[model samples]
Target: MAINYSKLFNRRATPQSQAIPGSGQVRNSAGGYSWEVTDWQRLDRFLILGAEGGTYYIGERDLVKQNHDAIIRCIKENGARVVDRIVEISDSGRAPKNDPAIFALALVTTHGDVAAKTKAFANLSKVCRIGTHLFHFAGYVNAMRGWGRGLRNAVGNWYNAQEPRELALQAIKYQQRDGWSHGDLLRLAHPKEVSREHAAIFRWMLSGQDELGERTVKRKVNCAERTATYAAVGELPALIQAFEQAKAAKGKGEILKLITESNLPREAVPTEWLNDAEVWDALLQKMPMTAMIRNLGKMTSVGLLKPMSAAAKLVVAKLSDQTALKRARVHPMAVLIAEKIYAQGRGDKGSLSWSPVQPIIDALDEAFYATFSNVEPCGKPVLLALDVSGSMGMAKIAGSCLSAREASAAMSLITAATEPDYVIVGFSAAANGHGGQWGGGEPGITPVNISPKMRLAEVVKEIEKIPMGGTDCALPMVWARRQKVNVSGFVTYTDSETWAGNIHPSQALRNYRDQFAADAKAVVVGMTSNDFTIADPKDRGMLDVVGFDTTAPAVIADFIRSD
Candidate 1:
């Protein structure tokens, strides 16, 4: 028996039989053939997923530049569309950070034509929602090119557009960031004062002077100087004034009094006082939903949140509040990070440590799913294939403290909780435990014991216990076919670096389709922007989505259930 040496068998050629426009193939980071998504698709990924912190296979500088170049090309093609996309992502809070959106906006303003620049400038407030954002935008725009008149007015309009009270709060809360301060922006933009309040705020940011000659307004840095005369000052915004009063308050009692009385934000309080349990309890009462979620560990560490304590009850109530989660635009990743960090009872990069409270840990576990948009159950058997390869677990990352490995574990919970029937399996060539070389071995698929009954933090820990090896994303479909498992859909959480296998994932899916579950769909959630995807572009049954996107569950459900 002789095999035909000249004929193709294992690989599927790019379908030239059907002349699909804009269809092209590219080699993945792991030297596997995968479909290349369009530039517009790549731009959405760059804006939402972000290439910051790099990936296991790529360095940060090169990753960022690759995304940057894609965005630049998109800007050149249709700048107004690019601006609209930025506004869409930023305004919806779909991204983990708004830096990518603002940077994209900066590109439009710098290189886009007049209409594009106008659109970018007009939507500046939407993209740069706060002073920190505006400052970062200013720096990116300034670095690319000098600030032209349009840029100055746009920056000035950002300041002018805000209500004086809101602007004052921003000035106090985010006085400086990204090497640009309210004062520096004021000096550079020279924003027109929209009202007397605006004039006072402008003056306050620029100089330590007040609207009237009553007293010197202590610049935020000089917050140590608490003056009694400022209490009588008429023009100071109430929040700003309360922040100063809280800073100047002589004792914990006074600061607590101010926090309760004035509804002062935690940011307004002096850093030294935050170490106090009493101060944290006081701050918790008035903290915004997002702030409360972020400070959960801090509050717990400071002894403010204890089991069955009033603070713990309040925190639990808030964590379980779906309406508040939606209102705060809380992403599932945020809750996952909080759960992982709080469960460990230690901060990853700080001296902070806390004794994990069981109630709070459980609350965070539930809250991670609540942060995502609701999705109807697909009512089908799903195979969740996790890429626990060398690249996926070699480093810890999915933005901030949540590692790709941890994030994929948490992401699977979305399915375990919603879908009635689903199975999770980890695929790696080295996990076989047969002394296979790091990148050389037959792909192994191990059944992962994950269920909604388990805490997400626990699931994360359990998944980490699995040995990792080189990626072979095809293993999901391959395993399903080999084991004759009835699968309605396949969802792979991977970095898309699957090179250890002889067959491509797309071909594996097709082969499985031919046997059973012909209608089966596969969704590949690429955790990193390493550029290639295993899902065939022409195959309507397969999809490629960005990992960590808050709306991913809903999107996945819709796609899987779609006809």
Candidate 2:
């Protein structure tokens, strides 16, 4: 794919001002911004990109020092108070555990002096749940190069093993089964600590003892070993062949055994394995409809039309069943999957056919509509404000193709649908007087109400129709207060990089509370990883949450109900 220089340049060029002192408005350059970094933003970058030693953007020694200092200051001041936020941000569900683990290792390797690094590592260790899963182990070992001593201590401490031998065995197993690089695994294995049997296996694999080579044999051996726990070594080959045949047949007995006994990695299983009729039938009998819906795209890709079509029929049949709909109503996963399905284009690879049968599309629409039923009706009236600013259109959600603007709209639609007495508005700065051009002159806030009853896709379309300009986050609350709507709560979905308005968002919320319902609360859902936050840290009525988290709606409801 060709690189889009213009888009890359524009993203870097976008200027963001800092509220902190000594960090003036920083224009985008080759490296280093002038603004003071916030803890959230610093940690966000750290988790996403790992440590930079004056190599990438903002990697200069002085700049890195400033970023590190800011983060340390935040930690020292907040202590355990910020621990939950750190864990939450680290587990943002954008990438697997590997990404964050690598970043954590990078922090230990690259940042701060000895004492500072130790403090940072201690803090990270408190939140980092390394070795909890296969990917976590793979990530830690992958990034363990040139840090053998640290790796040894980490495995001992983090894994809570008395001896390094247990850690070596686990590492070798992951390398053999999961296709992790052998060289990295060997470096961490510490030949002195490994048991003779495990060491032999590792050496055999690394030396290419068989024509099929180490990985192939290791996988078969691991599968067989896991399956025949009580069987002797001579029975391994037969056991491996039996396991393979069972997996290919997708027999229920073998499937259960593989999952329970062998603990086969889900990703390692071939798509064809999932395509089997017996497997689909078994899954439908055992798994919930929501889980099936989430995997629909994957099923479609492998041309499992019979199963995919059957699943679609099942979904449609359940749509009219109130009990079934009620069970799936509040879960956001269904809505998320439905939105992606609705947004998928013909050109998109591995997507459902360009013209999928009507029932499949209808099922998606119904699932999305059902999400509204899941929202517990907040008896009190509310106002939802969605930011449709140019900045909001700049980036897609971390792991998804949906842009921030689209996500904001989708979230707004859910809120509007759930609240019976609600007003939904999309806002951006108004055009300047000069031929209705954007920018300059006391720019005013523009807000437009979108119908709550509109379909989600339609709602997004209407939101897109709103003119995109400079962001003024306070405008929506300001508009609600000025209009005297008397809302009981306020919800704004934004990037939280508010700069256009003269008044801050917290101030606007305070003004709205004083003028209307003093007990009213506001929930600011941040859609991007910027440092700026509109919620007042000290205000009990204000709450800041990360967007795309399935639990956010429930959190908002609880906050609104709180005294």
TM-score to true structure, per model: 0.90, 0.62
List, residue by residue over 1-563, the lDDT tens digit for candidate 2: 99986543442222223232232433322211222235755555444322333221233455456545555554555534334445454544322122443344344434334554444344444444433343344454344334345444543344332233433334333444354434333434333323444444344334422333434432211111111011111222222333344446544567755544443333323455665554554444434455555555554444443425675566557544556654533344345545466346232446345334455655566565554324566678877888887767765554344567877777676666666787777777643211121654223444445664555567667777777876667777777776777888888887665555545566667778777888988888877544446676667888877665555666777677667
Per-candidate total of colliding backbone pairs: 1, 2
lDDT of 2: 0.51
Which stretches of model 1 miss by more than 4 angstroms? 1-3, 6-24, 209-234, 395-398, 430-443
Which residue pairs show collisions in model 2? Answer: 54-59, 330-374
**In model 1, which residue pairs have backbone atoms overlapping below 3 Å?**
397-403
| Superposed model 2: Cα runs more than 4 Å off | 1-98, 105-145, 153-179, 182-187, 190-295, 301-303, 306-309, 313-338, 342-354, 357-378, 431-455, 538-540
Best by TM-score: 1
TM-score of 1: 0.90
